[model samples]
Target: MTWLLLAGAIVSEVTATLCLRTASRPGAHKGWRVLVGAGYAAAFAFLSLALDAGMPLGVAYGIWAACGVALTAVASRVLFGEPLTRVMALGIGLIAAGVLLIELGAAH
Candidate 1:
């Protein structure tokens, strides 16, 4: 249950970030701003639920941040034609590895 909530938080956060990018674009519709705000609110709420369910703060946040960043970058490239440079991909890979280390450390 805690993991599920954390996953929800990650998805919400990534969606909010993408909506923010859309909202920042020239001639973007005002509705995107509303979506951005609501998505962030939902993300926080889900994160809080995960924390309440006894997930360690460091582990939860690490996973949420890493996955959110990686997913958002890929989504941006696919949806907005943004560039995914090799350097950026490498950074994302590092983030994933760090998160994995955090999770493994938390197990012991």
Candidate 2:
């Protein structure tokens, strides 16, 4: 349950970030702002729920941030034609590895 909540938080945060980018474009629909705000709100709500469910703060936050970043970058590349270079992919890999290390350390 805690993991599910954290996953929700990550997805919400990534969606909000993408919405923010869309809202920033010229002639973009104003309604995208509403979605951006709502997504962020939902993300925080889910994160709080995960915390309340006994997930450690450090582990939860690390995974949430890492996954959000990775997913957002890939989504941006696909949806917005954003440049996702090899170096950026390597960075994403490093972020995932770091999060994995954090989770492993938390287990000990």
Candidate 3:
């Protein structure tokens, strides 16, 4: 249940970030802003629920931020033709590794 809440937080955060990108574009529909706001709100709500469900803050936030970054990068590349260069991929990988270390460290 905690993992599911964390997953919701991650997905909401990523979607919000993507919507933010779209909202920044010239002549973009204003509705995107609404989605951006809602997504972020949902993300926080889910994150709080996860914490309430007994996930440690360090572990939950680490995983949420890492997954959000990775998924946002990939989704932006696919949806907007943005560059996902090798360096960026490596950076994401490093972030994932760092998050893994954080989770492991929190377990002990």
lDDT of each: 0.94, 0.96, 0.94
Candidate 3: list runs displaced more than 4 Å: none
List the candidate 1 regions with Cα displacement exceeding 4 Å. Answer: none
**Best-performing candidate as measured by lDDT:** 2
Question: Could you tell me which 10 consecutive residues in candidate 2 have the lowest summed lDDT?
Answer: 61-70
Return the lDDT, model 1, position 64: 89
Cα lDDT tens digits, model 2, 30-74, are 999999999999999999999999999999999999999999999
Cα error, residue 67 of model 3, in Å, equals 1.2
Q: How far is candidate 1 from the true structure (C-alpha RMSD, Å)?
A: 1.0
TM-score of each: 0.94, 0.97, 0.94
Specify the highest-TM-score model's number.
2
Candidate 3 has its poorest 10 consecutive residues by lDDT at: 99-108
Write candidate 1's Cα lDDT for 42-106 as tens digits.
Answer: 99999999999999999988898889989999999999999999999999899889988999999
CA RMSD, predictions in order:
1.0, 0.7, 1.0
Candidate 3 colliding pairs: none
- The parts of candidate 2 lying over 4 Å away from their true place are none
